[model samples]
Target chain A: MTYCVAMKLDSGMVFASDSRTNAGIDNISKFGKMRVFTRVGQRVIVTLSAGNLSITQSALNLLEQRARTNPDALGIWNAISLYDIAGLLGEAMREVKNRDGEFLRQNNIDASASFIVGGQIAGETQRLFQVYSEGNFIEASLETPYFQIGEIKYGKPIIDRILTPATDLTEATQCTLVSFDSTMRSNVSVGLPIDLLVYRNDSLSVDIQQRIEDGDPYFSQLATRWSEGLRGVFVNLPKPDWLTPKI
Target chain B: MTYCVAMKLDSGMVFASDSRTNAGIDNISKFGKMRVFTRVGQRVIVTLSAGNLSITQSALNLLEQRARTNPDALGIWNAISLYDIAGLLGEAMREVKNRDGEFLRQNNIDASASFIVGGQIAGETQRLFQVYSEGNFIEASLETPYFQIGEIKYGKPIIDRILTPATDLTEATQCTLVSFDSTMRSNVSVGLPIDLLVYRNDSLSVDIQQRIEDGDPYFSQLATRWSEGLRGVFVNLPKPDWLTPKI
Candidate 1:
């Protein structure tokens, strides 16, 4: 299982993904699930993936190979819109499904994948999409300014509560980390070494692509302070009056 | 969908369930999912259900009818151990499955139900069981002192962060409410008018059963304060140093 969340806020877009991938309780490994593609002044596209590691790898490999084969081809760098980039990703996964879906189905493995592709396209605004394995996608709107793929629920409440279209880039970054912290705390399958990137609107370069590992002071303090602060807030909240003994 | 959570703490046990039930977005209704059965001095059994409404209702009806028809029968009150009571509830569900499972399956409806049955029996300490659709159940242990059924993940992180075997009843009650608040905040399928029951250790009766209706002052205040407190804590958490524009 994996947890990846991306926010298309007013100031920019934020992306975060945990590195822990597991086949079972004992079979766990660290694999970066976030992919960054930047064309300096043209675009900065980030993609986060979840589901069937083999399929994810295959799809990503195909996308990279496509870019390497023809720099001016149908890859993300040449896509006309951010939505087009998402469709390209979906098409890559669909190609993988065409190749491996049947073999996996024969073995009872579901050939499924989920992705969050978000960023800007030169003159266009920041956009985000949650692409399904079926090669279809939907763009984020003001009403829903975020997209999350994979083990999303444990971290959803905080994002639902704290983030909005009007959130700033830095604040949304912090909120994204807190959301990942909540997820990692609850699920052992989503461990440390996080890929966090913040795309400031119109900044067609990926400068804040921080691959945060465990014990990073800033992240450690942020996680510890968030937990302690939540405890303090929880303890200070009103206790159950109905349970108090009546005199 | 539904949200039900039960905590087995050193001070006692706490159970809570939201009232919203929906087959789909269009078919929404409110129904109390928590049922409390008590023999004042002998036992206090609270059961919370999350699954096919017909199956759960049928199972509860069976348990009720069995107890009323034969006081000495294998009913909740007559059960020897808390485990037996859980088994009895499981048996009731199994009976429902046997009666309706095939018909429902024929119609493509999965005849499944999940339950959290927890309370104290005569000469027994407080116990909690998460009864699955198959009627088999697992007892909550010190390491895993809580069980959540239906839409569990959104509200899971809070309880996982706060509750422990050493937590007190009132604190656990507060924690459960906060958990429900998070669930309701994120998922519209889980709505208001919560059923909250606090079972004190060794007290074989139901005294603190609060059917908290929407706009109930205490609940309203708690929810508001909690939301505000969380926002405050979130804002105060240390921001990411990597994202701050140098100096």
Candidate 2:
């Protein structure tokens, strides 16, 4: 299981993904799922991947190979728009599917994956897209403002209640981490060593990236404070006043 | 779509359920899912049903008819333990399956249902059980003191974070409402008019039953306060320090 969330606020974009993969309970291990593509001052594309690790890794490898061999080809760095880069990523996914989808189907494993791709090209505004396994995609708008992939339900209510297009970049990052903490606490398959990246709109450069593991003091403080705050609220709600008398 | 939760704590028991049913998106309706059976000084058994409303309703009707015809013949009122009542409910479920399971399966509707049954007998302590469609059930022991059925994942994180056997009955009820509110906010299929039943340990009667509807002042107040409290916490959490020095 994986949990990755990305938000496109008016100020910037925020991306966070957990680093846990498991074929089964006994075979769990760490694998970071955030990939950064940049051609400094030209374009910066950040993607969060979830689902069958082999499929995602192969698709990513295909994308990297294309970037290296074919500079004039439609690649993330050279794409005219974020939409075009999303299309290129979808093309890579289909290529990987052609290579390995049949073998996975033969073994009864579904050839499935989901990706959240968000960043900016040199001439375009910052944008975000959720790419599906079928090589189709949808872009986020002001109304939706965010995209989440994998193990989403346990953490959805908070995001639905707290985030909006008007939210600031730093506040959006805080909300994303709180959402991740809720998911990580409820699920064993989503473990620590989280990757978070913040992209300031129109910067076309990458710098604000942090890798958080257990014992990270800042995350530790936020998690503890949130828990204690909830407990306090739970203790303060009014009890039932409708307990009628029974004969 | 439904959200029903039951908790067995040292102080007593708490049950909360939403009251919305829909065959499809266009045919949604309201129906009570919580049923109460009380023999006043002898036994009190409350059952909350979810999934395949027809199957559960038929099962409950069968149990009611059996009690009418022969009050002493394995009725909930005279069952020896809460466990016996859970078995009785399971038996009723199997009987319903035997009668209509084939027709429903042919029509492409599953003959599946889930029930949360709990209360106390005269000599027994408070107990809780979750009965399955196959007429088998599991009890909530000290290790895991709660059970939820239907549309569970959206509401699960809060309960997982806050509930324990040592939690007081009133606090347990508050937590259950919070859980239900979260589910309701995330899903339009699960709606209002919540049914809440509170049983103090060793009180072999029903008194603390509240049918909370939309516009109930106390519930409305609690819900508003909880939402505000969460937003407050989200705003207060410290922003990432590592975001500094971005180019």
Report the C-alpha lDDT of model 1 over A219-242, residue by residue, as the tens digit.
Answer: 899989988998898889886556
Counting clashing residue pairs in each candidate, in order, gives: 0, 0
State, as a TM-score between 0 and 1, how close model 1 is to the true structure.
0.96
- TM-scores for all candidates: the values are 0.96, 0.94
Which candidate should be chosen as best, given DockQ against the real structure?
A: 1
Give the per-residue Cα lDDT of candidate 2 at A157: 92
**Model 2 TM-score (2 dp):** 0.94
Q: Residue B132: error of model 2 in Å? A: 3.1
- For model 1, how does the per-residue alpha-carbon lDDT over B35-151 read when each residue is reduced to its tens digit? 988888898888999999899988999999888889887887688788998998898999889988998898898677899999988887888999999999999998999999988
Model 2 whole-model lDDT (C-alpha atoms): 0.88
Model 2 chain A TM-score equals: 0.96
Q: lDDT per residue, candidate 2, B29-141, as tens digits? A: 99999999888888888999999998899888888888889987887666688888888889988988898899988999877899999988898888899998798999999
Candidate 2 lDDT score at position A167: 86
Winner by lDDT: 2
